[model samples]
Target: MSLLQVSGLTRRFGGLVAVDGVEFNVAEGEIVGLLGPNGSGKTTVLNLLSGALAPDGGSIRFGEHAIHGLAAHRIARLGLARTFQLVRPLGSMDCRDNVIAGLAFGAERRWGSAAQREADDLLARVGLEGRGHAMPGELTYIDQKRLELARALALRPRLLLLDEWLAGLNPTELLEGIKLVQSLRQQGMAILLVEHVMDAIRSLCDRCLVMSAGKRIAIGLPGDVLSDPDVVRAYLGDDHA
Candidate 1:
């Protein structure tokens, strides 16, 4: 069965339809990509899945339960977690403390000392091993991204919704980011990554869903979807795709 399922998801703000009749599924242990142009509604879809926004019409199923209208923290308790496009680590808190914050405020929202052990492990998993006491402001841009991943990992989610995790990193950071996500897949967690970086999508995601104008345009393997002229045009321009 699919680990996460979204069907007929629609959201509207006045006359603007941010997401319209979109349907997709993420299987267990797979890394799936949601790709689209700017203002194409990718982030909005993630927001709905993360329960940050309610859908105008649709159903979201994690495992076998319906979670469309659950509170954001409720959704997290069900093993659904996400990271934002912006890395907002606490400047005063050290790396390990920042990760522990996820347990305090993330899905379950009732974590105690036991979650602290998990927090330490998450730091190592995201390549911040032994850097637990370092302040967020003291870290490099790449380390901040790693810290973000660690924070999300601290939630112990079965399915992760990553919103543009690779947006501002350098080439080296991007490569390392691929390794980070790939390791998640190896550990049997399913990820639905909504990203604009086609290079990362091609390398990391097993399948791709291309969206444009708030609708799904294509769904298939990375190479196949990336080669589609419509997807090309969506990324580059009418003349380029």
Candidate 2:
């Protein structure tokens, strides 16, 4: 059975339909790429799945729970976690403290020295090792992204939603990020990745789900769907395809 099942998911903003009848499944330990051009509603879907935004319609099932319209904290407690397209770390808190917050609040809650230790370990895992005492503003953009990812992992989530997590990285950092995501999947974590870096999508995702204008356009293996005329047209325009 799929770890996550989303069907007929829809969301609206005034007159704009940001996500329209989108549907997909993410199996246990599978990494599915949410691919789309700008304004394709990929992040909107993430918001719906992670409970940052309630859907206007459709159903979301994570394991045994039907989670449509659940609050974000409740969803996190139920073993789903997400990182923002823009990294959000506590400005005043140090990196380790930020991760500790996640540890305290997530599904498998921890506290005291154990949480501290785990927080430090998470920082190390995401390559923020000795920078635990540094504030969010002290880190570079890419490091900030890593810090956010570390916090999400602290949730010990069954499914993770990453919104443009690999966006600002240089080539080398991008490779490391890809490997880190792969390691998580290896350890049995399911991931829904929203990324424009086609290299990472091709290398890390088990399957690709493409969207355009808030609608699902295609879903298939990376190579197959990426090459489809419809998919090509969605990204580069009618002339390119």
Q: How many backbone clashes does candidate 2 have?
A: 0
Best by TM-score: 2
**TM-score of each candidate structure, all chains considered together:** 0.93, 0.98
Candidate 2 C-alpha lDDT tens digits along 106-125: 87789999999999999999
lDDT of 1 by residue, 9-119 (tens): 999999999899999999999899998988999999988998899999999999988999788888887888888888889888988889988878765664667776778
Which 10-residue span in candidate 2 carries the lowest summed lDDT?
Answer: 43-52
Task: Give the number of the best model, judged by lDDT.
Answer: 2
Candidate 1, residue 207: lDDT: 94
Stretches of candidate 1 exceeding 4 Å from the true structure: 105-113
Which residue pairs in candidate 2 have backbone atoms (N, alpha carbon, C) closer than 3 angstroms, thus clashing? Answer: none
Candidate 2 vs. true structure, TM-score: 0.98
Q: Against the true structure, what is every candidate's RMSD?
A: 1.8, 0.8
TM-score of 1: 0.93
